[model samples]
Target chain A: DAGITQSPRHKVTETGTPVTLRCHQTENHRYMYWYRQDPGHGLRLIHYSYGVKDTDKGEVSDGYSVSRSKTEDFLLTLESATSSQTSVYFCAISGSGDGLGFGYTFGSGTRLTVV
Target chain B: AQSVAQPEDQVNVAEGNPLTVKCTYSVSGNPYLFWYVQYPNRGLQFLLKYITGDNLVKGSYGFEAEFNKSQTSFHLKKPSALVSDSALYFCAVREKDTGRRALTFGSGTRLQVQP
Candidate 1:
């Protein structure tokens, strides 16, 4: 409960539609991350932001983009949704050097279904 | 490339018994190891981490892990298992030398505690 909140806890959309997921944190942490969880595959990083406007692609960033215009908010968008993009998305926050000493806190998560 | 492996896909234990989940990692420099738990439809929750210090690190929910440098292993352990402890566990690793502080996670192991 790091004062983190994710919008649209659950959603179902059609293929080719665009969708955006929001992750808001009150801790003001410097690092924000987007990850997707799926059965058998575990959690995979999609994108992350180290600072405002400083974003980078992750292992599974093919269809996802992230934005961090403010310290407290990180947004993840699917430019064009595909059925393969359906999964539970999570936002996590952490500070440099803490290295889990402070531990990374994750939002409740958003379940998206692409039909 | 930094990566982690959870050799076992699943583990079963009875209540009041001890449990162990094996995790091994590979990284260029000293590794930052982490354990996270996910339940049902929720997000990942940090269990513990091993940074720089004693080999044994204690974490939430009475869980602890030992960092074996020679073996490149960080196995999660608990003295007594509880039904509530059943969940999907993931092992993660990051290189200390890399300025890019993103974690590489293992496939995850499901733990089932029998009452």
Candidate 2:
């Protein structure tokens, strides 16, 4: 939770290759998210970005795809990798510009294992 | 399209006693609640939020939350229990004005805490 950062904390791909998961932040916080934590589906939202190219789609956006040109980087791509997309993948950041509920700052996950 | 419900996927306390981890939400207009905590791989953190006045909102370690907008629920309490306070617990929602603030989680609740 220190400025957010998630990148291959652990990975073991194979399914169909093509996999990218990276989210970096320096607390610029303008909202950037990409969640995926299975096990009864506790965390969905497959994509989110509020600026720097602006993004959308959530609620498990298809096979997942995202990119936030700049603004602290936010990329999550799984073009192929399957096996139900493995699990544990979280990257969150919120608009903590002193407004809008302030509650989000996660990044310590990225346990993808799509054997 | 905002929804969150952690109808007990797991909850069992013992330690010092007192503990409740339940959450319910369904935003449509006014709602910006949250409570996150994940340990054992780590990712989610932010412990409290209720973006308006105070229906009981304290956070961090001695967690607290109770923003029941007429039973929409936002339960997450801890009076004593501490077995290191178990882990995994999340409940989120956002819909104040719904310009797509991105936040709608709830599919987690696993707090053992037994000693």
**CA lDDT of each prediction against the hidden true structure:** 0.90, 0.86
Error of 2 at A94 (Å): 21
**For model 2, what is the alpha-carbon lDDT of residue B89?**
90
Q: What is the interface RMSD of each candidate, in Å?
A: 1.7, 9.5
Compare the candidates by lDDT and give the number of the best one.
1
lDDT of 2 by residue, A1-115 (tens): 6877888799998998899999999988888888889888888888899989989888778887898999999999999998999998988888857433666778988899999
lDDT of 2 at B92: 89
On the 0 to 100 scale, the lDDT of residue A53 in model 1 is 96
**lDDT of model number 1:** 0.90
Q: What is the CA-based DockQ of model 2? A: 0.32
Q: Please count the clashing residue pairs in each candidate, in the order shown.
A: 0, 0
